[model samples]
Target: MQQSLKTAGVLAFQRSLYATDAQFYSVLPHQQEKPVWVIRHGIRGTQNVNKATEKEFSNIQITDTAKLDPTAEKMKVVFDIKFFDLANSLFACAKGKKDKEKDTVKKFRATYDAFLTRAKDSHGLKEVVLRYVRNCTNGRWLWRNLTLASTATITVVKNDETEHGLSFDAVALSRKGFTDYTADELALAELFVANLQGYATDRFRVTALLDFGMPGVQVYPSQLYTSNKPKGFARPLYAVGAEEPVRTVEDVMHFQATRKMGQAALRDDKVANAIRTIDTWYPDYESIQRPIAIEPQGVSLELQERFRIKKASAFEIIQKIDELDPDSPNGMFMIASLIRGGVYSGE
Candidate 1:
């Protein structure tokens, strides 16, 4: 009889997909002029609700905001993505101490290899890549900004070669779910998969340009948390600029120090989360009818719920990879979780 194997004690995988901070720019319609950098502004207002003992006491609230130039008719968001080799056989590590544990680790490695092979051979990786591409083309990364724009155009250039790029109407694409794709979108998705499979010789750069058709509108950027904040101030939006003298509460807001091209930007992790919001395969997906970000246990912050529990969790599926079908939803989730990368030590 064959001996049962235990989960590996120490297992870790590095993230394969890397995204840079997305910069915001304002451009004039039907003009060839240089795009203007969106600048952050300091605004002051009075707090509506009174948390103090005195009902008449109103506190001043200072915050940061960014808006497009008055003459600008379009808002441009630009970001770069880099793909790394997705072979877990070399990047993922598994360690064991005793004889039985060593055997279990060996078996775990074998199972991972087998599953990876199946994923490559089947439609697993392609499905995941296509969903990611859909999210990018649909302007889902814009978050709140997408709703402000009446229309959007998304252009994706592979390796900075504009001639071999793809463009589409981002607003027409569905944000709630993944569905049909045009020929150009499919081509771009194929390139994404190729880079992930290590078929490309160089680390290809994929640049995403999202042009939103909203004139002189407010644009949203990721907000930075304030610690030991002033008495009356709100969280500040993320920006890149030089450190100026702390003359007021707004001066306490965070900004990246730079002499040139300083502007409000979205964090890399935020952009990555947007791109990886393809977890429609979770248990409650049928009821929710919307995709959440790919998480190990199918956690949705907005819903404040854990959809995948017990046997449905990624950690559980990973231990029994040998029994999983690479084409199934759970299998695809596991593959995506590996790509997201984290320590999965069963200790």
Candidate 2:
């Protein structure tokens, strides 16, 4: 595995927007540079929430270890969970593109104020378990329960450049030490992460994205199950033909994580795949003889032939969208539908 820094100091700074790329540079002080190949996870798409979750699993489980785990001991049962980037829905409605500046500001302030009030707890817990609802039985993996209230340090950014007019960065770290955690807890945590990494590598072939220092280009995750399937569990009766099925609580966690990663991959991959296709066809967007239209979503392309443009006229069609209309929808998203349905130059 390519070596990368994974110290507590580094991990703490990972969520800091102020942290520089130089701070995360992988080169060791005395070691010589070595070239290596890396597989990339596709960008998270808005539509493929399930797929996005998988990508994040691969990211945290596989890439974090192969490239970032400095301690020989695999990912500890105790790990940091950052909530800032993860909670997109909480702030999405605070500022709509069509909303006036004053209205957006008002919405943001009110929402944040209410959120802060509700979120604050004297006990320092953010999540709660109702008496009627059953919680996870295992203490080792309690952090996975999205409902548990773990102490978190939240960073709120207010600036003109930041998205949603208001932004937040929250991190919840497992304070328990390895020495204190029971053997079953540690083993279960390790097995769960390892399985996720294996699922990503085998299904999507995203070793490059999991590597350090790779380009930000997005890659698409596959929904198709790999022939080399996850073993030790039998497929449930209701989950027939499902590439991946939830056989246990651990499996459910992995399944949910994979969905989040898929959403992220879908959003990111649309543009990444589009740029790749256009670059391959025209060498660069600037070099094209014909002007190409781009929606905020991305260019149109295929998964297997991601570098190949779906149609020469896709750009022209998108250009004809009613830009003057306040309610006009932008060009179509270029990830799932484009990949599944071939494009036609003819309208």
- C-alpha RMSD values across all candidates: 4.4, 25.3
Model 1 TM-score (2 dp) = 0.86
Per-residue lDDT over 1-347 for candidate 2, one digit per residue giving the tens place of the 0 to 100 score = 42221111100011100110001112232432221112222232233336565435332221201122231111111111111221121222233344434453454335433432332221111111110001111221122211222322221122222232211111222222112333333332332223222221111110011121223222222222336544422121111111333246765555433211111111122222222221112223344332122222234333222222433333332223222111112122221112122322211
Per-model TM-score, in order, reads 0.86, 0.18
Q: Positional deviation of 340 in candidate 2, in angstroms?
A: 30
Candidate 2 has a TM-score of 0.18
Local distance difference test, each candidate: 0.74, 0.22
Q: Which stretches in model 1 have alpha-carbon errors above 4 Å?
A: 1-5, 29-42, 50-58, 88-92, 96-100, 201-214, 241-261
Top lDDT model: 1
Q: Where's the lowest-lDDT run of ten residues in candidate 2?
A: 126-135
For candidate 1, which ten residues in a row score worst on lDDT? 201-210
